[model samples]
Structures are given as C-alpha cells and as structure tokens.
Target: MSATQMDMLWMAYGKAGAVGSIRHEDDLFHVVMSDRREIGAYPTLEIAKGALISHLKPGTDRPEFRRV
Candidate 1:
C-alpha cells in the first residue's frame, strides 16, 4: 500500500510539551527531536519510538509518550 505524507509522519508528545517526531522516509524511520535534532534512523517504527522514549526518559520504568 502507498502511504500518504500524513501517514508517514508520527508525533510524540510528553507531559511537559512536544517531545519529537518519527518520519518514515527512504524505507527508514527517522527520529527527530523537538529542537530539530536528528537522532537516528531505525528499520522499524517501533524501534524508532523506543529510541525516542529512551533518550527522553532514561532509567524510568514507565515513560509516558502520547503518539499523535
């Protein structure tokens, strides 16, 4: 299936404010922070999401991240 631009974009939000976003491009999931910093690219969206969570909240059991 062909994914639209909107479908390729995923935003991650935290309790304080906007955390970051994950964009699917060139068959890779790119994790970009709120400050416009490119974290890294992952093979899957799940992995990309986890990287964001880990970077934001390290050593936390339950790091809350609202996907938008």
Candidate 2:
C-alpha cells in the first residue's frame, strides 16, 4: 500500500450498527470486525468492502462504508 492508502481508514456500518473496519497494510486491505475477528485480506479496497458487507447477518442491509 502507498503512504496515503496506509493512513486511510474505513468504517463499516450495517443495519445492526457498526460492523467493522477496513485498513490497508502490507499491500493488502484487511477487514476486521468490531468484535476483533479478522475476515481476511483482499487485493483491493472494493474486495475488502465486499467481504465486510457479506459478513453481515442474514437479512441485514448492505454495510455503509465511511472514510475516516
């Protein structure tokens, strides 16, 4: 990840409330839940966001990602 990407933070929110976060590190994007469970690392931000959204409970709305 580049310097700018490394400093960026993305918050994930779903119908249930705060779901997790996305951060760039070691050239990959990681999705970490509020409970501290790590989903996995992805090659790009879009993929990371998709993973986070997909991790939500069934019938939940897609997560809203906000940059922080």
Which candidate achieves the best TM-score against the true structure? 2
- What is candidate 2's lDDT per residue for 1-68, written digit by digit as tens? 35676757799887777889998878888899889999999999999998887887788888789998
Q: Which stretches of candidate 1 lie over 4 Å from their true place?
A: 4-7, 59-68
Candidate 1, 1-68: lDDT as tens digits: 35563348888866666778888888888999888989999988899988888777665353344545
TM-score of each: 0.74, 0.85
Candidate 1 overall lDDT versus native? 0.77
Give the C-alpha miss distance for residue 4 in model 1, angstroms. Answer: 4.1
The TM-score of candidate 1 is 0.74
lDDT of each: 0.77, 0.86
The Cα error of candidate 1 at residue 7, in Å, is 6.6
How many angstroms is residue 67 displaced in model 2 relative to the true structure, after the best TM-score fit?
0.8
C-alpha displacement of 10 in model 1, angstroms?
0.5
Query: After superposition, which runs of candidate 2 have C-alpha atoms over 4 Å from their true positions?
Result: none
